[model samples]
Target: METNFAELVDAEFALEPGITYLNTASLGIGPQRAAAALHHGADAWTSGRSTFAEAEAAVDSVRRAYARLTNVPPDRVAVGSTVSAHVGLIAAALPEGAEVLIADDDFASLVTPFATRHDVKLRSVPLERLADAVRPGTDLVAVSAVQSVDGRTADLTALRHAAEAAGARVLLDATQAAGWLPLQADGFDYVVCGAYKWLLCPRGVSLLTVREGSEDGISPHFAGWYNADDIWADLYGPIPEGSLASSARRFDSAPSYLPYLGAARSLALVEELGIDAIRAHDVALAERFHAGLASLGLDAPSRGSAIVAVPGLGRLAAPLADAGIFVATRGGRLRAAFHLYNGTADVDRLLDAVAGRL
Candidate 1:
């Protein structure tokens, strides 16, 4: 359960000395490369050296990076500012009275967008009952790839098969699972993620991937000039009718230049490190942490993913923070997430901090 790649990858992060960060699930530590790319983009924009073409190129890079990571075609990836915005668009595009199934424990971003829609009937079920809850009337199934609170990953293959059998589409929010886990585009009709979390980038940029041919079912309800096939021709010329881009770009939101630049760099770095290696390191660290928790008689909801949620440890968050270990508490559990930058030393620090308090 030792980590061999942590030191090499850890140097890329700007984490301070003597402090442990176990909250990648909440927000990833921004890498120096991403920061540099963001600063460079901002400088260019302020200096009037940045052109529309460069901005478009930056967005294209982000799309391509995410496409490569998810093994999807670049054209299938759409850009958004957050998972809620993109998923909200999908929810709005569904037929009126569409029945959408969601897990009660799923992140709010995955469930709220559809639940708030008056036209859509939302059904909430426990994670264990999701497959059973899917029926002929289910039009869509929405869930996070990894449960935010407990780091429990869904059986996507089983869920996708059931959804397909029931004529329902699957939408996955991959915010907590993308960088540390291997996410394929085939099992899901739509995959959305905010860049601030496991993507290791700044806020204000997200990836929304639409399966080919599935876009036809989703209306571009939030379409803007960015969705147009020819922005200049549609706006400046004769106001050409029906000028929307023919691909998933039709679902893209207006771009944020700096955030896109930073996201592109961060995603590129993730690719360079290789997702398999990152997952291996993360799982190893999580395994060690889980073992330590078990030895301390702590109850962990699940293991194997980057996150480990220990029940009854939520109250120790303040004490852990005082000890210079950062984690997240949700639903009365303390969530410790391991990333490429984490190692056994971090797990040891967390265990030590908790043992001392106990």
Candidate 2:
């Protein structure tokens, strides 16, 4: 696996000397291709050479690319600037006084949307017990495919079954799972993700895939000219009847085009490398870290995940950062996430740093 990605690391990433980046769960370091794309977009922007049509086409191309990657129709995928915005659409569509089942301690963006809805009764459960907790009255089951805190993964299959038995819909936040994990939105009623973390896109790019026939249910309260069939035509006037797209585009927020201009190249890199390969590479590095932690008599549950969270080590995050080993702290745990660009040396450096701090 190291041999497979040795050259890719050199070609894709441009980390500073003596730095070890193991925080892809927080923000992915984009490849040179994506960087180049961003620069090109910036040049076009400053030169006033880019047209609205070109920008719209580029954004839609990424939307279609995401749809194709997830095995869904392009019409079902909506582009947005944030997961909260996408989740807000789903929250708005729920019936009054509906019951929403969610995992406790989930990411704020995933939780706040449904929680903000005063009409819904939210049932909180542990991610591990989410499936068993679903009951007869659940109107919806919302969870993250990968928990942001401890790297625990949700059992989507079981959750789907439980939700189906309760006549409920399923929503999944794939922000932490999409790039290295093979993800398809067809299994759930709705899927929302921020692309900056795992998908290696710039900030301000998000994806929302609404299941077919869900278009009528969701009211796009945030809809703007960007969602119109002819965005240019609807730029000024009050949008007339039939102006908005009939599909999920009705939910597309006004885009930050420069980010989407660079997104396609990043997504294309994922397709070229294949997610399975990236997953293997990432999980291997994480497993190595877990073993190192165990050898040092630390609590390291072997979860077979790309992210490893070490209990009682949150205090070391600052020290590790100062030493050029970057990680995150969540739930009072030191979180280290491995990506395709990381290698065994990176893992060993982190373990060594932790050992020194101890």
Q: Which stretches of candidate 2 lie over 4 Å from their true place?
A: 1-5
* lDDT (CA) per prediction: 0.86, 0.87
The true-versus-predicted C-alpha distance at residue 17 of model 2, in Å, is: 1.2
How close is every model to the real structure, measured as TM-score?
Answer: 0.95, 0.96
Query: lDDT tens digits, residues 1-358, model 1?
Result: 2243555475678778988999999999888888988888889888988888877788888899999999999989989898899988888888889999998888988888887888889999988788888999899999888999899888888898899899999998999999989989756899998878888988999888999878866788777677888776566543333788888888999878888888888888888888898898899999998788789887686577999988877998988888789998999988899998877889999998898888
Backbone clashes under 3 angstroms, per model = 0, 0
For each candidate in turn, give its C-alpha RMSD to the true structure in angstroms. 2.0, 1.6
| lDDT for each residue of candidate 2 in 1-358, tens digit (9 for 90 to 100) | 5565667667888899999999999999999998998898899889988778777777878898788777799999999899998888889888989999999999999989888999899999888899999998888888999989988888888988888788888889999999887887888889998999888999999999999965665887887887888777889877875888888888899889999988988888877777888898899889899889989999754287788898889999998999999999987899999998888999999999999889
Q: Which ten residues in a row have the lowest lDDT in candidate 2?
A: 1-10
